[model samples]
Structure formats: structure tokens, C-alpha cells
Target: MMTMPTISNQNGAFPLLRKTELRRLLTEKQLQQLEQFCRASSKRAGSTLFRQGDPADTFHLLADGMVELRARPPGRRVYRTVELIGPSCTFGDEALFGETTYLTSSRVLETARVLALTRPAFDRLAANHPDIALGVLRCAGNCLIKTIRRSAILTQAPADVGLRMLLEELAGGNGNGAPIPVRITHAQLAGVLHVSRETVSRMLGQLASEGTVEVGRGIIRISSH
Candidate 1:
């Protein structure tokens, strides 16, 4: 059975979305109209928002917390996390553009609030407001570019270098001395790096031994020294 989202009252009071890429693309009027289509909901951690291959019927905007996009290739026991969606970002645009099914499964990584618009609603909005449609297209294009770049990195870089680059990104290039704020598992890191969990564990251990990083339960702190 398909799960229904738990609805909440937002009353179009989401100011954060106005600071995102969507705001850059949409005019004030368009933004207001777009919000009119939204219905807010709250999801608990570990809840699956939608599964891969499910019928694409809605688009979502993360109002708070995190969501992970994972894709399971056929005959594979594990799913790779393709992207992490954070607050103020939108997802599920593939559905708006006529995709029949979701390309990846979305699962909540933390307690989250989301604003959703059904495909039909999005289509109507797009039909009436060409600027909103254009903005969404640009956003989707940017996401595609990032995905392509990540694929290139995974294929071209050595596992350790790729892992380091990923850590640096998570750490926000804090001079290699600051802790990466996000906590992740070896399995998830393995998926992102296109490597095995054992490989990730071994590399992390080596880094820890070298004083390059400090590993704790669910955390890895990079050493700036």
C-alpha cells in the first residue's frame, strides 16, 4: 500500500524558498502563485518519501532537515546515494517534466518538513506561468550537470583521492582542520565513492592512524594540523 503524507499547516509562510535558486528564477508574483499549490507535511527520520519506479505524481520542496536520494541498480543488493537534498531545495522535477516514474527513491535522513505539489498542479502552474517552467528547467539542468560531474569523479579518481575530495567538500574546505558537520556511515560513503564498504573502512582507518582524521561513531573529524 502507498503511504500518505501527514499534512501540516504552512499557509504559504515559507520565506526560505525565496532565498534559493528558485527565487532567482521566479518573479515575486510567480513565487506567490507557486506557493499556492503547495501542501506542507512532516516526515520522520528513515521514512521513505517515494520509491524508485513509483509513479511520479508530486514535486517536493524541503522546508527543513535532510533527504537522501538512493538508486538501486538491478541485481544489486545495495543502493547508492545519488544526492542529498537539504532545506530550501526542491526535488522531483523529473515528474513535472513528464517522467512516468521516479528515477530514485527518497528517504528522510532526519525529521523533516516538506512542501509538495502534485504533478497536475505543477503542470497547470507551468502552463499558466512560463517563467516558473523555465526556472524549473534550469534547476533540473543544473542538477543533471552535478550528477554528471560526480560520475566523472568516481570513474576517474582513485578511491582515496575521491574520498578526500568528498570529505573536503563536506568539511567546506575548512583548512583540513574543522570537523565535517554531517555524520555519515561507511556504507553510505562507499556508495557515494562507488567503492566497497571494506575499502572505505580501510581508508578511514589509515587516515585516522596518520592523524589526518579522527573517526568516531557516526562522525569523522578532519585534522587541520
Candidate 2:
């Protein structure tokens, strides 16, 4: 719980969320309505944005840098990182629904710019601007869908399959049935897959022999087909 620095314009105008999935869900006027409640903050690494079980009174969007969302299990001493959120992603949408709390804590992984919309502010906006409210809900719904989809892939797919899917996602696909080379280490892949470094390296070697990927140093170039 380090100190946090925040900046809110007099008019409450923050346009940084334009890069998020929300931008597609909201019309220009609806987006303006939502922005009127925005408060921006610059947080250093190690800053705690919110904690598990905290009253979910604010929704957050990362305008820049990264944050780690983590949770401690009932008997665990250390928190496990569940996700690494990047720019334009919204989180803590539990605030948008009534009487809910955060399931995990968010910590700044890098110096970050965050935009927050408080519950009270959102309440007022919802009352006066239902269209905007609905738009925000739609965006949150889409996020939930992606989370469910990602969970399915991680839990249901085999290790090598899951790794391939993850690589495709990170590579962002080259659109012509090819994957752009991505720079990442075996340790990073192991952390995400909840496997060991040796396991990731072995899988990569297998994939290389199969002509599925070429791994060198710290990068992986996945085959198109």
C-alpha cells in the first residue's frame, strides 16, 4: 500500500480510455458522459491499486504501463498473479453492479497511468445517462466473455496446445495465416502456463522439431500453418 498520486481535471475529462474495448461499445456522447467521472492517477511500481475484499467502489482503466492482478488462496501466504493487465484494459467492474467486492488485489507492475470512475459518480451518470450506463455494461460483458474464453483455453487444452494458443495470442497473428515473431523468455511462458522452465523449454524443442516454431535466444517465431 504505497502512496499513490492522482490527477483529476476540473471538468473530469480523461480521454485515455479511447484505446480500450469500451470505445467500441460507447458512442461519442456516451463516452463523454462516462469521462465526466474519470480521475487519472500515476502510480509507481509496487503501488497497490486495490485489495481483495475491498469495497468495489471504483472501476479502473489502465491508460499506460502494466498492473498485476493477484490473489492469495484461503491458506496461502503469498499471492499468485492471475493476470498482467496492459494499457486500455478496464478492471474492477464489480463496482458497476451493486453490493460486490474485488476478488483479487491489483498492484502496479510498472509505472502506470490509471483512470478510475467511482461508484457514486457512476451512479449519478447511470441515473442521468442510461445510454452511457448500458454501453459501459456492454463493454464489461465483453470483457467477462474473454475471461471465460481464456480460462477455458488454459484449463482444457493440453500443455503444448495451450502454449501454441498463447503464442498466437501474444504474436497478434500476422492476418495472412502467419504469426509475427514475439520476444519472450521461457520463464515468462512457464509463469503463464503454471509450468516449470524445463517444461516450457522441452515443449518448445518439441514444437521446433515439428516445424511449428523456431526458438532462439529469447524469441519464438511460430509457423503460419
Candidate 3:
């Protein structure tokens, strides 16, 4: 089997997960105890830890690495990139809506380590640790609000506008340089832009012709010009 290339971080093996409000939100008695049983598990690049429509009773805390939340749109061979999650992130809270299935699959973009906790386990813990559960609920609520906002933006914005928004977001992320070195495939860009691969290529060609961007084999650079 072919092996994938490894990308190393400047600081350490993985990005540091700082103590943010998100982390603090999960620090209740239930989460504190769940933390004790926490086993950090890792996966290889291009690996999928969970698939869409799978059971969603557990919450996964991504301790390290990047994950892509994807969905296979009807009649499409491609899995669209719905969201990109980084370290110190939690996923699968959609299950709390009493839904038995997941809305999207979680795939590993790189080697990843995650802490998994089931809803039953969290519930038992939360029964005695109400404050932590409340905090967790609040965190989930915030995520839902953000999702709503993103949906509104996508629905109202033009394709180029949406793509530019994503570019700015990636460029502003920590550790990314001014040139915004984003190396991704055209197909990947299609997924991100919620367009067909052909559309992505055509739009990208237009951008390049306009001197607004440059595209190589699988990488694209949004230029300042």
C-alpha cells in the first residue's frame, strides 16, 4: 500500500490544546471523571474514524490533528467537505437531538488522536454532575448557533464570495503565513465551495486569468493581486 506524507508542526508533534472556555466547559465532575478514563487514540492519514449516518451516541474530543466532516451528496461520487475541525474540538453533539444517525462522516486528514465518550457514560456522570452537563449543553448550543450563521452566509453569498470567505478564514488561522499556503486538490476545493469539480476548475481558471489566484497541480494560492 502507498504511504502518505507526514507534516510536522514547528512547536511539537501536535498543536497545543490550550485551556479555553470550550475546554473549561467540559471540565465538570462528569467530564473530569470521563477524562480519567480517557484513552488517547490515533489514526493514520486518509483514515475514517466514523462514517455518516452511523450511530451518534458518543462525543469525540479531538485532542490532536485535523478532521474533515463530509457528506456524499446525492448522485455524486465525491464527498463534500461540510466542515474542517482542528485540535481541542468536540464533535457528534448532534446526537443530543435524539437523532440516532450522524449527519456527516468524520475523516482524518492527518494522523489524529481523539478521546471518545459515550452519551450513556456522560449521562451517568452528568446525573450527579449537573453543572458540567449544563456547561456541555451551552457549548453545544454555541456550536449550533455558529452552524446557523454559517448556513445563512452560504445561502446568501455568491459562489466566489463564499470561496473568498473560506480563503480569508484559512489565511487568518494561527501559524498560516501571509501568502496563505493552502495546498489542496481541485476536488477538495469543490467540496469546500459546495460546487461541482468542473465548476471549481472553471471558477479557479477565471480567478487565475484575472490574476486573483494561481493554481498548480493540486495546490491553489489566492494572490493579493
Candidate 4:
């Protein structure tokens, strides 16, 4: 069993988590109780946080930086990125509801500060605070529903349409007028879009020529005009 480290106020981890959506659902006293159950860690880019099939014993919250959730279908050679979790997002929430194993692996994409609560601690919290537990469950359920809808919509679309939709989503639906806030590579985009890297590159090139977008090293920006 993995042991949780003692939490302290010196690291200022509580204030960081307080700004996340999770905090909105929890009262100040509940938040303080939550802090008691969490342990903080700093991870470097490229570090694997957890792997699919691993025991889902902890739930994680990203206090800073980014992480990617990826999955390798059985017998598949390459992993597909299912989601890119930014700061203030929580992952592994399923563990709180009795999930035994992780469905996807998570990797840090940048230097990240993370706070995690063990399943035992979470169960205790849920047992003691029904309101907080209900709120967290609702939040997790909504996120799961959104992810399901996005996957269903994207998978049913033609590759080109899916690609465009993805780009728009990354741009926060600011139309084609705003630059995508995140830097991404063609291969990474391919993984998310479930297309070949060559296909992604060729399509991007076509979009560039048509003045729909501009692609550069590790970046793709939608044109305002």
C-alpha cells in the first residue's frame, strides 16, 4: 500500500485547491477537512502519474500545470490522448465512487504540482460529510457526461470535421478569430483525432494554404480573417 505524506500549510497547497471548482462545492470547514486528507507532490514533465489498470487508490487535483489522460486500447501499439487536464481540474474522481482500477493513464505534460487524497481518506470524508460528498459526486457525473458527449460527437464526424471541431474546442469556441491557447504537435493532435500523423499534417497544410489556419513548430493558430 502507498502511504500518504503528512500535509502542511507551509506548502500553501490548500489555497491552490481552494480556487478550483471543487472548492466551490465545499465549505471552508469542509475544505480544511479535505486538506487534512491530501498529500502534495511536484512532478516533472514526462512523468507518468498513473497507468491504466493500476489500482485506483488516489484521486488527484492539478494545482498547477498540465497533465494528459491517455489510453491504449487492447492490442493497440499507440496510446490515444483522451483529454488534456489543465490547472484547477481534478482527475481520478472515479476512485471516490468505488472504481477499482484506472481506465486511462495520466502523464504530466509540464512541471506540475498535484494534491492527492487516498481512497480511504476520501471514503471517510464522504461518510462524514454527506453534502460535500453529494456535491463532488454531481461534479464528477457532469464531467463524465460531457466527456461522453464529446467522444460520441467526435467519433461520428468525418475526420476533417472532427479536426475542425477539436480546434474550435481548444480555442474555446471563439470562432476562427482567436489563437489556440495551447501549443500542440501534429502527432499529439493525431492521437486525439484518431487519425494518422500524415493525415493530420496534410490536412493542416491544406488548411494553411486556404488561409483557415497557420501552423508552426508545435503550434497551430486559427486565422482571424
C-alpha TM-scores of all predictions: 0.82, 0.73, 0.72, 0.78
- Cα lDDT of model 2 by residue, 31-96, tens digit: 776777777667777778889888888988777776767777898887666665656677887788
- 2 versus 4: better TM-score goes to: 4
Question: What's the true lDDT of residue 2 in model 1?
Answer: 54
lDDT for each of the candidates?
0.75, 0.75, 0.63, 0.75
Question: What C-alpha root-mean-square deviation, in Å, does candidate 4 show against the real structure?
Answer: 4.2
Question: Which of the two, 1 or 3, has more lDDT?
Answer: 1
> Lowest summed lDDT over 10 consecutive residues: which window, candidate 1?
7-16
Location of the lowest summed lDDT over 10 successive residues in candidate 2: 5-14
Question: Which window of 10 residues has the lowest lDDT sum in candidate 3?
Answer: 11-20
Which is the better candidate, 2 or 3, if ranked by TM-score? 2
| Best model per TM-score | 1
lDDT of 3 at 221: 72
lDDT of 4: 0.75
Give stretches of model 1 more than 4 Å off. 1-13, 86-89, 172-178, 210-212, 222-225
Pairwise TM-score winner, candidates 1 and 2: 1
Quote model 3's TM-score.
0.72
TM-score-wise, the better of 3 and 4 is 4
Off by over 4 Å in 2: 1-13, 167-225
